[model samples]
Target chain A: MITKNRKITFILSLISAIIGIMFAIQLKSNMNPVPNESRSIAELRSSLQKELEKHKGLLADISKYNLLFYQYESSLNEGDSVSVMKEELARAKRMAGMVGLEGEGTVVRIQDAVIPEPPPLSDLEEHSYIPNAVIDEDLRWLSNILFANGAKAISINGHRIIATTAIRNVGEDIQIDTKTIRPPYEIKALGDPDVLISGLKLEGAEENLKLAGKQLIIEKHDKLLIPAYTDARVIRFMKPVKTKGES
Target chain B: MANRKFYLYLTLVTISTGFLIAASIESTKARNTERQNEKQFQQETQLNERILAEKKENHQLEVQLLELQRKVSQVEEALAQRQSEAAEILSELEAARMMAGVVPVSGPGVIVTMQDSEQAAASADVTKYIVHEQDVRLMVNELRAAGAEAISINGQRLVSNSEIRCVGPTIIVNGVKSAAPFVITAIGDPATMVGGLHLPGGVMNMLQDYVKIDIQEKEHVEIPAYVGDGKMDSSAS
Candidate 1:
């Protein structure tokens, strides 16, 4: 009986030791703190901000080169041959709308005409919701008129209206060379302000402008800044036929 | 009495041994699972490091590109400043040809072809079925809006003062009269130009209502310059 008691006590002591070791390990693991979620998120945000700053720096460098190139091209040179070349270059630049010109010009602002609410009268029934509001054709007509009246350079909303520049409606937006501009459209013509203003008064122009349901605001500015064309002018598809002894 | 005491001790010994075996097995399984978690954590950390390295490399390459661009600009400026009379004249002549749309240019662009609907002959209003000058004008307008560097309609280069007007059954583009189907070749970024035309309710949608229009993105497109008379007379003062 004494031997049996000794055996049972030994087994009980062994089991208790095993239980104690397991509990100790679990307690140690639980005591360690969990990772801080907020800290990790803050780290991620900081990295993203750093990346964006780097990207901006690169873009600024590119623009700096662009400005320098423009300045170099516009600088005048000496000598007879160089002068003639310069003159031709200047002419080409103007014709291509690559140079910004400032002159006494007229600014025509065209905005959507606000239709008044119907007064609930029988005569006013047809007047509600007048759908005409400064469509693409109005601007085209005005631009054509300006050109015909000897406007040297014309720009609409900073987009130099060159021969290749097209004013078209893309889903309620007027896009000029991948740039979408909104009303009120400011059309600037670099010419005699008086002449341009008078040109707008030509036959069928004023009538056409009024019928388009646009609020027309015309004024004269002594110095209007028309921006240069900032897109590629590379030509392909039609080569100049070689004249006699041209090569 | 002695036998009963022996049996009780034996039962206690067996129960304790069972408890020891169970605890060891549970601990080993927990350790194996924890090892897998650690392996996953290490892989995640390696991926993060790779991402950081790649980003740093990208930044370095971008800086190099910027530096090279500045160098090119500087060189160009110097060259322009020191160019001889003949060189300047030649360059200006080339520039003139480019602006006049008389020089061939090759670049990435999109090609658009418009064909009259074959089924339109049976329809009452065949005018709407055929590609009109208005349709060509709208397409060219959209292409220009999409930043097309150069554009041509059925091999006629559109330069300054080029007109697209309908004369009876045919369309006159740049004084070169052509009937449907008009092929418009433009040189620019293929994707942006195509995207601009294909935008919902855009030029493609509007033109597709009348004629069958097909657009394709080409990696390289060649546009011939204006082959007509080089009339620089339209220079507006």
Candidate 2:
């Protein structure tokens, strides 16, 4: 008994209501953080990124077993094999954090954006050396050093260490991620400093810093706390590398 | 006549029922297929990622192993080169130890300085001009072309994985801001690293034409620690 227009309206309304219900259910699953694709660099910037969360999860899972053995490691069994293994594991984790391999490494600040510096005329003496572009050269060298040192996570300043972190001189200052970090910027490496430092030296990266009157420091810290990753888990979703048949 | 009408009504009902069932079946099948496709894609991607990661780890091990073998072979190479084996081991250790990142070794290298001068407004005395991102890019490309084995800017270490970006009027290196005077360091054989710039239209001459950025060579140089994120994903390898 319904007219054509009335029937169309009813069907449309039904579809809308069903869609609304589906969206409402989805919203309930994830509260607070709106999801977006996570680039590795964003997570690396925060001190408590998702990688840190993962490490904590790992620690929690391992601690369940560790607690049973901790009781066993009392008075008589001070140097038990299990205890020794635990200690070794701790050392490895510390080393990993130092060079940014396993856990997040301590932040070794490199530079900050204070006002600007006035240059002296005497600095431009005849035959004085000068650099051309900064971003490209510096980034290439840093990447070379990191790979050599076995760093798994590195943050220039506040930027998270993602797979896409770039080092380029945009205009006035050297740009890292999207922020401008002036000197002396701290570089937080999540791996062993010794290995990282040595690797940089082998590639001759250290040589350049010295000639330029730059401050270079390598420290071995116990841990680096990173923030939880709040971005989307999947990346580049629309463009499927595989074809429909393959998928 | 009554039987004929009854038959016609039964046929209509049968047709409508068949159409509805067919539509429902098609929709269900499509949903299942979509789900199956998604699952297969994820599995394949994961497998590819695992294989790539293993290869990268294997490559690192291989490079380290090669360096070790080079040191051991130094027993012969040192004698042939007429260098002291003790000194040769020291040099080789210094090089190989770097990849392993065990020690900081000093070496000859190059230093590049950049300054950005804001364009003069109404009342400012100026010496030249501001530094641009392209200037930095040119210098980096020049250094690489000159065969500089390593480089860093504002303590952001350059590796095979490092990236630099240009934002507005500033330069970002490994997510760090390094304004003028921007210093770029390159490590390599001092003679070659420095000499490489002497060629025509290289970084040095270009600097002279541009902001007249400075370039210096040091017999002993020490590059700073890298401060970029080194997150390793399974697919990045």
Candidate 3:
């Protein structure tokens, strides 16, 4: 009779434990219905658009400084000090893509490939299907290829390719820095045109582009003009490290 | 005696049952109250919306700040024009040049020469033995932290936006091609820069196992100015 009673106590404890676990789960769900699902798709889209507009205004302001710096430079007279400054500024501007570059190189333009839409109610049709787009990763690889193959300066749709420049996708748009550029990406490189053209063909670049559903158009320009970066960021946070014994 | 023990067990069980029932009843009541508070749930959603809106407003203010700074520069230009302070302008321009890394610089610092390990050639995976762009970037960062006035890898000077990246087997510095045995030159106080590079678990120690690293303290190291197109033609735009 004692053994039967002990078994009944064990069964009761197991049933109570299961009930407690279910209660805890229900409490957790009540606290957090869905994590990070607060913002709707429409809200995110508008926020990104607002950010792009603000960036444009900032760029316009920086261009004014660029104009003043030039005027000051031209005002200086012919002297050792003045000449050195001019030479240095000119060199710095060229490297920083503040100046236009014209050289014999290749221009690669990539566009999204057109694919036929599947029939309605077909098994192949997917509800979450994303259309073919020339992604940032594709452009990054293409630019890296050109840079590696002796391209001195490069510009994509007037945006100068620089070290700090980031290629990122916001929703569906490909953003370089703050500029959102559309399809038919034009990449102009300033280097040996023959070498640049040949380099793209190397390492199955065409095959990779095809797999990504992109069409490539390569043209060798004797004088391809690549524009400078209009917006130069002012370094406010990073000051030069001061050495010892300096005021 | 057996009857007394049974009665004690029965009393304990009855108390536990009463406690469990009371706790369960309280939990259900609390849950019902939470479900009824629709205002709290709406506030949470509204709070998230406010955060995104605030971010947009912040960017708008930044744009206004940039515009004001641009106007201030315009005023400065006008004032300078009236004063005709050529000497002052020339000095400012000179300082700009130095910061721009367009002129050759020389100072006391350390030279780091890194080469692929000889045994790496025989290893199945040779990638581990070769020096990478990150390795160069780490050394450059350490030197800068130690108050390096100037830095260069091979002949390529490290600039503000300069990228040191690897493409295939070669590492590219400032758009210049480079192979193994990268000789990095830094201009700063000889003692401090050396200490920064050779610190415990520093870049030198970390890369020593994969690549042969040699450090030399020099009285003077000259870094040549960038020879590429350094001038911008603003008129073209």
Candidate 4:
């Protein structure tokens, strides 16, 4: 009996030690930081792929600028700098959203969804819940999706989106660049219509709008014109960074 | 009696051990669900490192591109000094470039930093506590309305075509992925921008519940020039 009792105690102690070791390991792992816990492997790969493509684009841009610099230097020596400067200025104006653009692209229109009238006194709580109509965020997302799909220029209700342009919501109205726009928002984009349509489809733009009690209508146009930015505020706060040999 | 006592002690020891084992297993299981297998973890780490390295290289290229652009501009400036026609166009070009965000600018402005709230990770509704692209967009819009002349987010210059959006857990600005806390630098009147942001029922009031935002007024804020070609694929008439 004495021997059996000793054996049992020995086994129990062994089991306890093993459990203690496991508990220590569990505590250590819990303390370690897992930064990528929320992201999956597929997501990581896609992000990395995007970064790679951006890197390639950056490389091409660097080379293009280098060539431009050489061209400008030689033109200066040839005494034909005025024409070159004029052409460069024109290009700059286009990039600054100061000139209108035309191309084959897509136009998307969003309008409020029609809701049927509910029975009187069915449920007071249900009647009190009002669906949100088209808001500024929806427009912002639509434009972003359009841009991501290679849209060169985008305008909503004739308000061209520029670097400084902001689409916002003020009380009951939506404003683009501080100008209030009414319902039936028409968004015109300059790009390949097929690509833009696919981009929107991939994002389930129509379904998302439907969920928010809005209807999305997409149309393809062979020739679409997007207006230039109209609100050109005087740039009073910023001055260009001075380089060497400049006044 | 001695034997009975020994049995009682053994039973107690066994019961406690069982509880300890159960607790440890439960904790470990929770962690396992959060993390994938060893191979996946390794791949993720490698991918992250590679992406970071590529970003660094891109930064270097951007700097080089900026230098080339400045040289071209200097040549134009020199030529402008010699001729009156060239001088008129040169000034217009400079202003256009600044408006296009192709050139870097500096002035007195405000720097706004936004981060996810401390309780975001612990909250069940993480979306409510985390920052979204719309929040950043609203902030930028408010700044622009307050007369901000230049703006950049996380060192990525905002051009006419720049899009601020989210993919999964990352915020993609100007085609580059970044995570919070986002630092937005805007060149404008410091006081006016602050006032605009602080207005009742403004962006600050809306986002105060979800995000932690800090705005600092500085005398000098340098916004970098955009580094892309800025060329429209379609025809510009």
Pick by TM-score: which candidate is best?
4
Q: Highest lDDT among the candidates is held by which one?
A: 4
User: A83-105 in candidate 1: lDDT tens per residue?
Assistant: 54455466556656677667677
The true-versus-predicted C-alpha distance at residue B36 of model 2, in Å, is 58
Per-candidate interface DockQ score: 0.06, 0.03, 0.03, 0.38
Every model's TM-score: 0.51, 0.31, 0.42, 0.77
Candidate with more favorable, higher lDDT: 3 or 4: 4
Give per-residue CA lDDT, model 4, range B7-77, as digits (tens). Answer: 66776676567657766776689678756566676887898898799878877776676677778878888
Interface RMSD of each: 19.3, 20.2, 18.7, 5.6
* TM-score quality measure for candidate 2: 0.31
* Chain B, per-candidate TM-score: 0.59, 0.49, 0.58, 0.74
**lDDT tens readout by residue for model 4, A66-106:** 76676776773535667777777888888888888888899
Q: How well does candidate 1 reproduce the true complex, by DockQ?
A: 0.06
Cα lDDT of all candidates, in order?
A: 0.66, 0.48, 0.63, 0.81
Off by over 4 Å in 3: A1-84, A114-132, A237-247, B1-170, B175-237
Error of 4 at B7 (Å): 22
lDDT of 1 at A134: 68
Question: How far off is residue B78 in model 1, in Å?
Answer: 16
| Ranking according to DockQ, highest score first | 4, 1, 3, 2
| Residue B150, candidate 3: C-alpha displacement in angstroms | 12
